[model samples]
Target: MTTNMTTKTLYLLCSAAPPVFDVAHVVEDAQARGWDVCLGLTPTAAHWLSGSLDGLAALTGHAVRWQYKLPGEPDVWPPADALLFAPATFNSVNAWALGLTDRFVVGVAAEAIGKGTPVVAMPCTNSAIAAHPQFDQSLAVLRTAGVELLYGESGFTPGPAGLDTPPHFPWQLALDAVDRHPTAQA
Candidate 1:
């Protein structure tokens, strides 16, 4: 169990979906295992969360990115080791899979994927959207692009599941996936 894994840099992209609490739990767990976590919240998501960016920064010790604003001048772009999009809204998922980078999360994901960085997307949207033909196609595209889509315990949970805080299992599972991958080693 004494592997020399380099410190992981995790970029968490949050959407307005209700499952964001689950995403928070994942971030906290990732931090516990020495991963540096940075959060990028969609404007809609920030409005829905009802918390200040400062609060998030204090909690994670990293600045919260609310827009696609680059880190320059007053900001510094953090080098990401990996990217995770938990509770990804159907809209965001489709946009990301289809190469639409109008949003910060999608933009970052595109960049990371281009750089061969590991990407895991945990999409949480309505069942209808998840079942839509377009959604299926989008997932196929992401898979072909080397993005690991975790369809949750099943094939993606839909609708608001009341954010029953994800038990530590998901975080452990994510880390384990990273460890098992040869490229994840420093």
Candidate 2:
């Protein structure tokens, strides 16, 4: 039987890094699939990925959010169907892993997880950081909490035995993951 599923909303949380190229493509793809996409960018990330937000907004038909709050206004939180953190920087990953939510992206992610929103994180970093013991522990914690970690290219590189590899990005993998999630259709 085929299921008629509609994407309600998707939150794209980004961090500052060159890997952000992957994120822009993913956001565009998500919008193409009829998902409402909102971008929550870290302060540093905003500077790097500034121009891309206009393109994202054009494609998604929604404004991207960077600061925690609008100028002189209270917080306005957007409801999201799924949260995808692409090119998740090492800093943000560590912060979220240890329950720190100082930044808007990490804070929103924490809130989403607390409310049972499905989360897909595409962590992009060097091999050394990816293989760090602390990073592994953080991944374990997130996994235990039901967060799906889409470890980036580093995870797929052939190396040690018994290592699992993640599929590539472009929001297709994220959409597939969401399709498998019980809440995505709801």
Candidate 3:
């Protein structure tokens, strides 16, 4: 199905991770579900998708934003009804929970929560990183603030540390969770 600009807007804030390269799949899937998707990447994720920026822009019909725009820069993207933080790194999660908004993705995610936007996050950290005390605390903080975190049983779990395979990044689950959020329907 072709999603037009009039559909509900979703700001997909992608962080750097192995799954960052597969963001096109999420965009297409979201579009198929009738969302007008806008992508906001962390600096690193933007670099990772640098070669495909034009393609991404064409697909979303909007520029993929990473850095903060100048004060007078005309905003081209539609207002977002929801924000999905996919491939969220451990750093981004922790930073966001602590109210750090230095990076565009983290900053936007933080602001979205404060604005009561329907927000969903899919963290892509390994068990080792997830085991950090701060990681658990961050998850707790976000969950307390009504952020839908796609982690543990409801989301992706880390694979064996030494395995050659990366844990499957559940891009679709993030969208599903967002759709299920009360704010989205409100």
Candidate 4:
């Protein structure tokens, strides 16, 4: 049932944000930190990285899963000890909070809450979307449901809407948060 029993499994779920472009580095970092990393992407993210999908799968030594498996089909990746949802877009965050499973990554994240899987999410969005009242409400819902959300000053700080250079995403912060989670410690 486990991929590498000695190594903790981390389901690195990513949405289609600019940060997603640098995910290969993040995977390497996670591997160096002793995690058995399994990369999962949102549909659009999968499309964005279509050309490099093979390389990513080879990097993680696991299938890059973006779509749900058919009924009666076996799961591809190992069960997660913890999950890190990084560069989560506004839509992904809200969808996850509301239990919308249309996207594979969001579905897994939403289900992880009830499965008692430790989850750390760092949402990537512009200041314009961050200002939405619904986004705040969605954040509250996720927090109340025991999801470790990294937003505002704690993690990803959204810059102005049209900044030529968006604020650098703090991948290390999210990784550190995952390390601090109970499941990861176990």
Which prediction has the highest lDDT against the true structure?
4
Rank the models by lDDT, top first.
4, 3, 2, 1
TM-scores, all models, native as reference: 0.80, 0.79, 0.92, 0.95
RMSD per prediction, one decimal? 4.4, 5.8, 1.9, 2.2
Report the lDDT tens digits of candidate 3 across residue range 39-144: 9999998998899999999898888899988899987777789999988889999999999898988988898888889888988888887888999999999999
Candidate 3 similarity to native, TM-score: 0.92
Q: In lDDT terms, how accurate is model 4?
A: 0.89
User: Clashing residue pairs in candidate 4, if any?
Assistant: none
Could you tell which candidate, 2 or 4, scores higher by lDDT? 4
TM-score of 2: 0.79
lDDT per prediction? 0.69, 0.70, 0.85, 0.89
* Candidate 1 residue pairs in clash (backbone atoms < 3 Å): none
Report lDDT (Cα) of residue 34, candidate 3. 71
Residue range with the least summed lDDT across 10 consecutive positions in model 3: 1-10
Candidate 4 matches the true fold with a TM-score of 0.95
Error of 1 at 155 (Å): 6.1
Q: Give the alpha carbon lDDT tens digit for every residue of 1-186 in model 4.
A: 124544789999999998999999999888877788889999999999999999999889999999999999999887999999998999999999888898899999988888999999999999998899999999999999998989888998999888744669999999899988766874
Better of 1 and 2 by TM-score: 1
Q: Deviation in angstroms for 15 in model 3?
A: 0.7
lDDT of model 2, residue 156 = 24
